[model samples]
Target: MITSIAQAVALFAATNIDDIVVLSLFFARGAKRPHITRTILLGQYLGFFGILTVAAITSYGAVTLLPAGAIPYFGLIPLALGIKAGWDTIRGIDEDEDGAGRSLALPTVAAVTFANGGDNIGVYVPVFVSNSPQVVAVYCGVFLVLVSAMVFLARFIATRPGIGEWLERSERYVFPLVLIVLGIVILAEGHAFGL
Candidate 1:
């Protein structure tokens, strides 16, 4: 149980580190509006759970349908997403910025959160498949607790003076780089490329 909790903490932190920037940005923007904070929180939870649900379901399917030897191939998902994010970065494409007049609607925030969490799915699916159902339940519980903590941390950062701005400025560069490194690590660790 302790090992499961530790693994869950590590996995969630690895996959969702980028989310802090995104959430902090939302909180910073919503600071003036105030009413949108609740929407943001709700959307974040909904989107995160959506990612977890997909990961869990895919893990179940993979375990049921694939040979044990093929499980490591799941690492390709993050690798592909990382490469795509890198390519987009090279093209000077910026998807993180809000449009001039866009509203912070619940669906928009949820969609953005879900979209940003593609790598989480990639990492979670394989890990989930390798664990027992009870361990996965423990993981989910840990994740739930951490999600609230994450929101609080982001809110605190966003309310601060300059830290949030710095994070926002650096996020575009850091996010893709982190994803690429994480993908490589996952692939190498899993021996997905026969490394």
Candidate 2:
């Protein structure tokens, strides 16, 4: 289970790679500003760590407080994130205006980061469902990886050549497809758990 927790954290963080990419794209479109990106990333890290802690605790608490069957019901988490990402990707897949994008405010960045990591909470419920295991360390590992990668991506993209204004034109179709597939998988997992 320790390994699984670690793996889950990795998966959770990796799952957010797209968000980093999208943010990177936005940063590239905007003027390069390490300080701004740092501020945004700080908030982003806080969101990631905060959610992970809550997820670990909630999963542990839920299993003890609720019925065993109710545990899997939490699978809705990653499912939703995947679906949202997929849909958003489809809606904004264009690569235009890569460096002309604006940086988000700290709170907005934090909120977006939280939204991006929303489904990850479900990743924790399973850990507790089986044995009430503690996955905090693994979650922390994932958080570290995510923050590190995000910082690098933001820095790299902010200085890279711009793509002009076209990111939105193409993503419309792509994101929806991602959403549908991710949604189905999550729903399928939910079905299995219910059984």
Candidate 3:
């Protein structure tokens, strides 16, 4: 359980490294602070839990329909997503942007988060499937707490021009690298590559 919490934190942090920058950008907009903050936080929670719920349901199906030993193969999903994200980053693509003409409403932010979180589901499913139900709950709880912290941290950093600028500039490279490395770790740990 302790290890699960720690792993959950690491996964959440790694997967959300770019979120701080995005949230910072959103905050930099002329919108009211409270409104933007509320939207970001609420959107993050809704998007996160929505992904988790789907992953949990998928986990249930995988656990029942597949052999226990095959569960680790689910790690390949994140590995592939990470590779694609890295490629997109290298190509200067921004899939995280809100859809065309999508206004920055609470629902819009939530939808954007959900859309950008394909890798989240990939990373989440294997973890959720392999763990006991209690551990999954623990991971979800830890993730929710971390999401709040991430919002607060992003808001604080957004208020600082220098730090926010640095994060925005660097995250383009750093975030993809983190995702790739996380994928490698997940694959190696789960033996998803049949190593």
Candidate 4:
């Protein structure tokens, strides 16, 4: 149980680092569209859960086909995502477009979230594959709470202006590092790579 909670936190933090910037942009736009914040949050939730459902389906299939001992191999998914994130950072690729100019719309925000989270599905499937239904339930609950907290934090930072800018600037370095460390943790814990 404790391990599941910790894994959930790690996965959420690793996967959602870029979301802070996106959410901040959404909140900033909320000034013009009064419903922007709610729309962004709702869209994010819908997109995130949609991705999770896909991961769950993949996990179910993988578990049924693979042997129990091969479960840990799923850690490669996050490891690869982490490496890609780090590489993107090194290559100066910006995942979050200057959301400052984007028009606030529910479908657009949801589509952006869903597309941006392609990497998340990789990480989520492996984690879900290693867990039971009950553990996955706990992860879902924890993820819900954390995502809410993230939205609030992003909204607060957006309203602040200064903090939001600072976060956006620093997040480039910090977020990729978080992904790398998370990948290492997942690999280590799963005893992948013959460790």
- Per lDDT, the best of the predicted structures is 1
Pick by TM-score: 1 or 2, better one: 1
TM-score for each model: 0.64, 0.53, 0.61, 0.61
Q: What number of clashing residue pairs does each candidate have, in the order they appear?
A: 0, 30, 0, 0
For candidate 3, the TM-score is 0.61
The candidate scoring highest on TM-score is 1
Q: Candidate 1: lDDT of 139?
A: 92
lDDT for residue 157 in candidate 3, whole number 0-100: 81
RMSD of 3: 7.7
| Reference-based lDDT, residue 103, model 1 | 39
Badly placed stretches (over 4 Å) of model 1 are 62-102, 164-195
The 10-residue segment of model 4 with minimum total lDDT is: 94-103
**Which stretches of candidate 3 lie above 4 Å from their native place?**
30-34, 62-103, 162-195
lDDT tens readout by residue for model 1, 27-111 = 6545555466688888888988887887788898843344444545554544565576567768876543553321356765575
Judged by whole-model lDDT over C-alpha atoms, candidate 4 comes out at: 0.67
Residue 131 alpha-carbon offset, candidate 1, angstroms: 0.7
